[model samples]
Target: MNSVYVDLAIGLVIAFLLFSLLVSGINEGLVRILSIRSKFLWAYLRDMLDGAEGKRSWIPGTIREVFARLPFGNKDARPKFDPLPPPVRSTATTWSGRLYERLREIDHNTSGRTSIAFVPPGRFAVAMMEMTATEGGVPAMLEQLRQDGSPLYGPLKGIWDSAKDDAEAFRKGVEAWFEGEMQRLTVLYRKYVRWVIAALGLVLTLFFSMDSLEYGKAILTDNAVRAQVAATADGGAAALERRLRDKCPEHPSDPYACVTEILASPAFVQIVGNAPVSVRIPDTGDPQWLWNGGDWLNRLVSPAHWPGFLVTFFALMFGAPFWWDILRRLTGIKLRQPDPTP
Candidate 1:
């Protein structure tokens, strides 16, 4: 019985610790991966726009000239090229329109996809990574186009680089704002984690202390627990002997079996919660155990469960943030701020 209570208490503490660790690791790891990818994309785009690479590619060039003349850009920069053969002309127009639609869809989706981990490394890192990669990719793409001998290559490269640059700059500015918020977020995360762990610790400690105190009090009071032992020495022992003699007149071993069976009766189950009050056995100075409907009534009404589940519920809720942070640190993941605009 003593060992059972000790095991229960130890199990509760261990379960709480494991829950915290699991949540923390998953959240932090996600943040770090997103931040890294965002920075890489940003730097690639910037490098493309600045023409850091030697030569401009043709496909991106033509697309740039077309969009540049849209209502948003310089209207005067519109192109005046000769008409193409029917098949070539139709293919070029269809491809160009499809490309335009795709770009627009991507721009719309970018707003919803932003994350927190990008803030810690700062906007400059994002910008440099994006610009360098895109600028470097242009020359390589141009060589592919030239070898493939694709017509309308000039327009494609023009539009691609211009549109790509604008997107890179906008993303950089957004990340810059998030960078300013990173410090504040870090402080808030720490405070929340500490508060939860402390609260859970306090509750768990109280539960164990209260359970121990109650058991100790029961033992010292000579209440229900004390009466059961006294019963055996009084009528309980004699009744066992009489029953064995009646059942097996010639069997000497039957008396010991009878005694063992009496000791292991259902009447000896522990008094859990509000059970029947122990009855005072007449002339024995010991209590006789009987069901009084108290245990059933208490089981239905009482909120307390064995060791008190109040401590368990609080331990779970409060421990979430602390566990989240520990996992983030171990995984080198950044905590992302919730998007302010959203």
Candidate 2:
């Protein structure tokens, strides 16, 4: 019983690590599909640019271009998908960096000494709005700001129009609206990732023929097969990990990246190299052993397969990293401890 339990543990750990990689890929895929980072950046900049007090503002071309690429960049498509963008680095060459350059440009024009990350919302609003303002009151100022016909103007104009005649009210309302949008963005990203994980997990489960339902009978009675799987599991696990070693980001900023990296890793997406190890059981016909009394029991099928599916899916939400962490610790301890069976 103990030996059989050890085999089960070995097989399960390997499965989890592989499956977690699949889940991670699905999560990242969804992020790319939505173009979440670009959308969030646009929302933030839209908030900063809105001013109803006849204030002038400047919108950088670089920032506007990125915004145009937002939410998949296809205005006419029902849902558009884009290739994943590179990670946002703090340097100016990346999307986030370009936005910073624009912020610095704004600060230079306004003679305000503020870092891009911590610029006050109201201060930014005044700078951007007033820059575009011309020699006139609200109507003339709005006309100058809206002249370029940039996509950003639509949202900014909405804020201006909502004021009717109250510039200060419009300013406050714009910031408030932006804050609400920020909150919604967080929730939206989370929900999107979860749905992706669930769908991908199910597909992977089927692809790998991890039909725990089908394997249950053999697992319960076939000691020889389990022993073979356990003995070879470490090698199989190492192979899988090697394939995944460069596939995922080692230290990702969020769940989305972690998942994407796992998915992108070089792995067998099907049951080719991913199947369980098998072994031949000794066929001693002599009834000298009690275990030989019922060889046919190995073929007995369990009707309760849903439990395996449910347990696997639920465990996967913990992600590949969580299981990998434990696997690492166990391996460390295992390396240091003397083998009991030895």
If scored against the real structure, what TM-score would every candidate get? 0.24, 0.39
**Model 1 clash number:** 35
Measured by TM-score, the strongest candidate is 2
Q: Cα lDDT of all candidates, in order?
A: 0.39, 0.47
Show model 1 residue runs off by greater than 4 Å: 1-9, 19-180, 187-301, 318-342
The lDDT of model 1 is 0.39
Write model 2 residue lDDT over 13-122, tens digit each, in one string: 66687788877876567555564444444444443433211242222134344334434444321111222231233232222233343344433222222223234456
lDDT of 1 by residue, 1-342 (tens): 565444444433444555445444543463354342333232222232222233642112343432232213221111122232222112222222222222231232233332222224344334323432443554454454456443423533453455575645544543554454455545644543444344444444333222322333343333332344455446664654654455335444566554444343322122232344434343346666666565545543454543434444455555655545544554467968899895
Candidate 2 at 147: error in angstroms?
Answer: 17
Error of 2 at 243 (Å): 36
